[model samples]
Target: VTITDDSEDDCQYEEVAADDEFSIQEGDEDLPKALQTIQEHAEDAQILASQSVLLSEKSVSEVPEAVDDFLCNFLVRLGMSRTLDCFQTEWYELIQRGVLSAKDTGLVPSVYTRNQELEMENMHLKKDLENYKLAANKAKEALLKMQKERDFHRMHHKRVVQEKSRLICDIKRLKTHYASYEPVLKHLTEKYQTTLRQKMLTNLERDRAVGQITGLQAALQNLESG
Candidate 1:
């Protein structure tokens, strides 16, 4: 009877080991299903990320044209509105609006999607901040360049004024030297004085006639020559 008890105990031990082995194999069978679920989830997440990025990049003016797209379509199908009449402020307000009830599209997986969205938004904000910093730096550099150009122009204007004053002084000295020759040159001048005076008067009258016409025309001609 003692030998019989020992034999029974040995059989029970072997059976327990065999059951453990079976259990391990059965657990392995569930792995494929879990992996497949994960894969499907990852694919959905990728699609959602792509869509979110596209939506974020779209201009305010461009949003209405995509009225039949995912979020809009979903809202419309839910009997929210017929037209995509919501503007910029209304759009953001809607995102912040809490749902009293929502579609039970698998709560666990929907939470995962929401997590992915939050991570995506964080990444987008970081990138946007970087872009804004870069733009601000560029504007500063451009402003500095403009200021330098303005300073250079101011200095050049001062130099031009000084040079103009010197040229005028030289012209005055030359006119003084020519004044002595004016009397001796009268014999040659008298030969055609009457004709020259008549020509000068005619030119003056022509100029006065042109001045009486249109001031705008004269201004336009001055601009074109410059």
Candidate 2:
């Protein structure tokens, strides 16, 4: 059997032997059926080979078209002309430096190194986040302490104010009581002074009466002697 690749640039064919060429015993009753099976297998293999060739050709033809479409959509339509130019320059440089070869179909070492750097940066960010959380916790604790202190001071001030108000009310009540008693105190002082003056006048009048009585008795004695 001969298989040809018609779509290829250098079309070629490979010769494969058909299964009928296999030797069989002439007197065997299953020889025809066995030959028919072998022939069918050979036909199937040829069909498979032809289909594989067609698929290969199709894949090869579509590669450039796919690349073109990707470039148009990513660079031209998105207006990334500078990025496209830079990518082309980098590709050329990579080719010239032999960094990009047939065996290497992916990004170069720098891309991998950048990925490592990004991972390190992520780790640093995680550490910073933890530190920030710790600081926030401390700050929250301090805020709670301050609030308690404020509440204590506010209560202390309120108690002091209440005490001061009580003192003021007591002072005002004392003054009012003093004012109500002032008139009675003054009247008692005047009555005591009048009673003392009347007692002194009564003593002076009794002494005068005693002196007059003594003088009359002396006159009676002189008349009896004469």
Candidate 3:
């Protein structure tokens, strides 16, 4: 069982890894929590940088056929490894003492081998199930984050829409407010045009009067010269 368990040493278990983080958090109450979290992630990132990740692969080991091997496998499958080690010592001693017959260490039945294989398969399935659950949890976290972002954007969009509506209303009010000046502006423009026309007519009349006066002066000079 130990051999089979160590067959693929992909990643080591770090079950007590959070103890260090908890200790740091407890020891440094004055430190900002965000800084502490950043430090933790930095250390984790260093581990990832230093080691090459090995992908986990499923492996099925064939159970040994011997009686002792079967008992060892059984104890290991049942998680009684300490007892199995002690029993192995006793088992060899009894064999050396000749208290056990040859049939005792003979080949085990096919059913026990099949059962052990089934147990191994069941263990693999449990591990796979755990991996699936972990993936589901990460996906759930991502989905929740996305939903929060969606809601945040939706809120911003609503604010923008409200702001846009307010601007539209303000523009409409400004148009109506300024609309009141149109008639006054028209009246002023007409009055300016009328004043300009009157000024132009006075200039033309003044020029004609000056021309008539000059003609009369020229006629008087001609008569006096005659």
Candidate 4:
């Protein structure tokens, strides 16, 4: 049998017979019963397909009840009594624990809102972290500049101190040399004064001797003439 949807889509249904010894042959009394059973199975298949389409179109928040109903029917149909019981127990526990609540489910608007808020906060934190990293780099650069300036000043100060020490040593050496020559300079000055005075006295005594010799010569000439 074939079922066509509102959109004119044709869906074909193929029925498989269950593994049973009941075979309906032509002109058998069970032919009508077999036909009725096939029709019932075809109706059930059509209803199941429609339900599946509805479930697929429904949102997660609207799915729990539909899923529960579908599972109950499916388990009973399949004769999985024990599995059905276990599934019901687990489903009840989840519902009680609020795990299947509408608010906790991703179908709610609040979940999306909360996710947007978290994303905004994460963006802000990342921006702040970048700013902090830039500040740290600037601080490191400033520290390096200060260290270089300090090193330069320290080197300049050391050189100045060394030059000052050298000048002080030179001054002391010059003072010592002057001190050692002071007495010799003083003795030379006194000796020069004494030599000047002795030269003046010797010149005066030579002039007196020359004047006496001239007067005796004049007396001798006058006696010879008389």
By TM-score, is 1 or 4 better? 4
Q: For candidate 3, lDDT tens digit of each residue in 1-226?
A: 3234444475466565745544554466665785778687788867865564322222333333778887887787789989999999999999999999988876677688888779889999999999999999999999999999999999999999999999999999999999999999999999999999999999999999999999999999999999
Q: Across residues 81-145, which tens digit of lDDT does each residue of candidate 1 receive?
A: 74555633465465467432233211233354456458668889999999999999999999999
Q: Rate the local accuracy (lDDT) of all candidates.
A: 0.64, 0.71, 0.81, 0.73
Per-residue lDDT over 79-177 for candidate 2, one digit per residue giving the tens place of the 0 to 100 score: 898988887787668878998765443323444445645866888999999999999999999999999999999999999999999999999999999
Arrange candidates by lDDT, descending.
3, 4, 2, 1
Can you list the residue pairs that collide in candidate 3?
Answer: none
Clashing residue pairs, backbone N/CA/C < 3 A, model 4: none
Lowest-sum lDDT 10-residue window in model 3 = 54-63
Instruction: Find the candidate with the highest TM-score and give its number.
Output: 3
lDDT of 3: 0.81
Minimum summed lDDT over a 10-residue window in model 1 is located at 1-10
Ranking by TM-score: 3, 4, 2, 1
For every candidate, C-alpha RMSD to the true structure in Å? 33.5, 18.6, 24.3, 21.0
Clashes of each: 0, 0, 0, 0
Best by lDDT: 3
